[model samples]
Each structure stands twice: as C-alpha cells, then as structure tokens.
Target: MKILVVGGYGVGKTTLVGAISEIEPLTTEADVTEASTDQDRTAGTEAKATTTVALDFGRITLLRHGLQLLLFGAPGQPRFWFMWDDLATGALGAVVMADTRRLADCFPIVEYCERLRLPFVVAVNEFDGSFPYLAEEVRDALALTERVPIRTCDAREPASVQAVLITLAEHALALHRAQRPLTH
Candidate 1:
C-alpha cells in the first residue's frame, strides 16, 4: 500500500523514511540557498542545510502482515505543495509528522488529510531541546479529534519510525473495515 509522510519544512519526514526503509531511500534533497531564504521558514530548524525539493521514496515490508508499504515523503515548503495532489494519488493513508517546536506548521498537513478523508496518525518527532508534549497535549494543540491517533517518536530511530508506521497502518485498516458494507 502507498502511504505519505508529510509535514512542514524541516519536520523530519525524510529522516523518518530513511530510518525505516529497508532499501536505500531515494531523496530529492537540495541545498538551502539564499534564493529560498524568504520562502522556507527556518525558525526552529536553522541547522538544517538541505530540504526535500521533490519527494523521498522508500519501501518496507511488514512480514507479519504480509504487507509492503510504499512511502512517499512530500516536500514540505508551501511552494512545493503543488506536487501534493499528484503524490497523494492512490495513497492508502498518511503519517503527518509533527514538531512541537513548530506545532502550528503541521496544521495544513492535518487539514489536507482531513479534506481528503485520508486516515492518518500524527507522529510527534521529538527533537533535542524541544519541550516534550504528551500525546494528548499535542492533540489539543492541533485541535484534533480523539479518534485520531497521536504518538511521540524520534525520527532518527528506526524502531520509533516503525512504531508510528504500524499505528497508521492499524488505524487505516480499522477505518477501512468500518466503512465496508456488511452483507448477510
């Protein structure tokens, strides 16, 4: 199944894909140049020297479930959002990576998923020196419904990324089942 990893610029969508992908992840990262200084906001991510200009592609197999997931990391800058519609085609669901330091940056991603009726889970990428907000706190901050799963994770850790992916897969499955009409 195809899944999206989307969030605001510098929120670690690429990092999460690279961490969990069994194969060598494909990334379209470009150096942060002065030309984009005014376009890309770097308030909490000043240390970031590169940004995903297109998308990051990765794949992982859930052996237990016999499912293979195709991950597509969307470019975060608003200027690149034009590619989002194409990337979202045939997507089963998405993981909306969140950064507590720039929590509001993720609002658009969340709204996009909601508008598409896409099942998604918010994975809070725990950055060093950033305040640790509980899952509930994040949901409240994002004004998300209780049904949406919100979990914390370290994008750099493969295990952490895997856990978030599992959460999204399960949530999507549950929603799919609920929507299917029953035949007696």
Candidate 2:
C-alpha cells in the first residue's frame, strides 16, 4: 500500500511519518537559509530550522495482515509543489494534516486530492497552546464534504499516528467499496 502524508509548511508531515515508521525514515530535509526567506512561508513554524525539499519516505509492515505501507511525505513549501504530482503518482490515498493556527494552508492539498479523485482523511495535528476545536467544527471550517473523515491527533505520538493511519485506511477501503461495481 502507498500513502501520501500531505500538509502545509511546518504542519508535522515528517514528524508523523517518523513517529510510526518501522524503519529509518528517509527524509530530504534541507536547512532553511536566508536566501530563500522571501519564497518560503515560515509563519506557523517559526522554530523550524529545516524543510523537506523533496520528500520523506518510510515503510510500516503489518506482518499479521501481510501488508506493507509505503508512506511518502510531500514537501510543504509552495515552491516545491512541482514535485507533488510525481509524488502522488500511484498513491492509494492521503492523510491531509492541518494545524488550526493556519487552517488556510490546507486548502491547496485538499483541492489537490479532490481534483485527482483521490480518497483522503483530514488529520488535525494538535499543537500545544492551540485552541481546542471539535472535529465537526473543523469539518465545517474547512468546508469539507460529509464523506471526508476529520480527526485530531498529536502527530508526534506513535499510537496517535497509528490511529490516524487506521482511520485513513478504513476510510479508503470504504471509498473503494463504494466505488466498486456490484457483481452477481
């Protein structure tokens, strides 16, 4: 199985992938330099020193179910969006991570998935000191349709990340079933 962990800049895409990956996650993070300060948006992630320039790759093997998930984290910066289509190729679905502080940042990714007809679940990455918002409220705020699942989690926790992935998998399966033609 292939999945893309996508979100806006500094929304914890790499952290989420690393938290649950069974192997050493492959990350292409580059130091944020002053040269591109004007190009990169660093509003919500002021403390972030590095950015994923290409992608983050990781794998999780579910031995019992005989499933191995290849997780890919897309680069969040707008300038790197050229890499998104290539990364999204052959992906089964996506987890759209969002931070309430900068909710608008998630619009592009949501639209990207929708335009591609890709199934996705929205995961609100709960950051400390951030205001508490219900899943329903977030759904409404994002103007998401009823079919898209919305859930909250601390992306840094392995268990929490696993739950998000589980939700995503279930949602994807449901979508697949719904789209499948009924046979005799």
Candidate 3:
C-alpha cells in the first residue's frame, strides 16, 4: 500500500514519517534558502528548519498483515503545489495534517485529495500541552462532511503517528470492499 503524508510547514509531517518508518527513510530536504523564506511563513510551524525541496519517502511493513507500505511526504509550500500531483499519483490514501493555529494552510491539501478521490484522514498535530480541540468543531471549521475521519495526535509520538496510518488503512480497506460486488 502507498500513502501520502501531507500538511502545513512545521506541522511535523517529516517527524511523523520518521517516527513510524521501519526501515531507513529517504527524505528530500534542502537548506532553507533565504530566498524561499517568504513562501514558508505559516504561524504555527515556524520552527521548521529544513524545507522539503522535493519530497519525503519511507517504507515499512505491518507485522499484523505483512503489508508493505510506502509513504510519500509532500512539501508544504504552496510554491511546490506542482509536486502535489505527482506525489499523489497511485497513492492508496493520504493523511492531511493540520495545525490548529494555521489551519488554512491545510485546505489546499484537503482539496487536492478530494479532487483525486483519494481516501484521506485529517490529523491535528498538537503543540506543547495545548488542550485538545473538538473534532466536531474542527469539522465545522474545515467545512468537512461527516464522511472524513478527523483525528487528533501529536506528530512527535510514534504511536500516534501509527494510529493515523491505521485509520487510513482501515478507511482504504472499507473503500476497497465497497467498490467490489457483494461476494455472498
């Protein structure tokens, strides 16, 4: 299975990928070239040091199902929107991360997943000890329908990151089952 992990700058998309990756991960990160600073201004994720010049890729195996999963992390910068199409191609699903403080940065990703008809889950990456935001409130804020699964997690936690992957996997399975004829 192939998955695309996407979110706003400094939202811990890379960290999430690293936390759950079983094998050596491949990431395309470049020094924060001063010229591109203008494109990296998102309030909640200002701590991001290296900008993903291309994309982040990783692979893992789920022991439970013996499923090999490939993950592609898309660069968050709007200027890199061109890369989104390619990263999304052939992905089984995607996890769109969002920072409560700068939620708008995630809309483009959500829209892209919608356009591609890819099953996706929205994960809220918490910062510090901040209180949890209501999932329904987030749903209303993002104007998302009830069909989209919304989850809250700390991108820094391996378990949390894995949970997001599990959610997407389950969603993908359901979608696949729904597409086929009943095999009674």
Best by TM-score: 2
Of candidates 3 and 2, the better by lDDT: 2
Off by over 4 Å in 2: none
Per residue, candidate 3 scores C-alpha lDDT tens digits across 1-184 of 8899998777878888888888767888887766777656755545656778688888889788898999898888888878988888889999999888878887878888898989999999888855678999889888899988999988878899888888998988898888989977
Query: How much is 158 displaced in model 2, in angstroms?
Result: 0.8
Q: Alpha carbon lDDT of residue 115, candidate 2?
A: 98
Model 1: pairs clashing at backbone N, Cα or C within 3 Å: none
Clashing pairs in 3: none
Please give the TM-score that candidate 2 achieves against the real structure.
0.97
> By lDDT, is 1 or 3 better?
1
Better lDDT candidate (1, 2): 1
Alpha-carbon TM-score of each model against the true structure: 0.97, 0.97, 0.92
In the range 1-184, model 1's lDDT, one tens digit per residue, is 9999999999999999999999999999999988887777778777889999999999999799888999999999999999999999999999999999999898898999999999999999989899999999999999999999998999999999989988998999999999999989
* Stretches of model 3 off by over 4 angstroms after superposition: 129-131
lDDT of each: 0.93, 0.92, 0.85
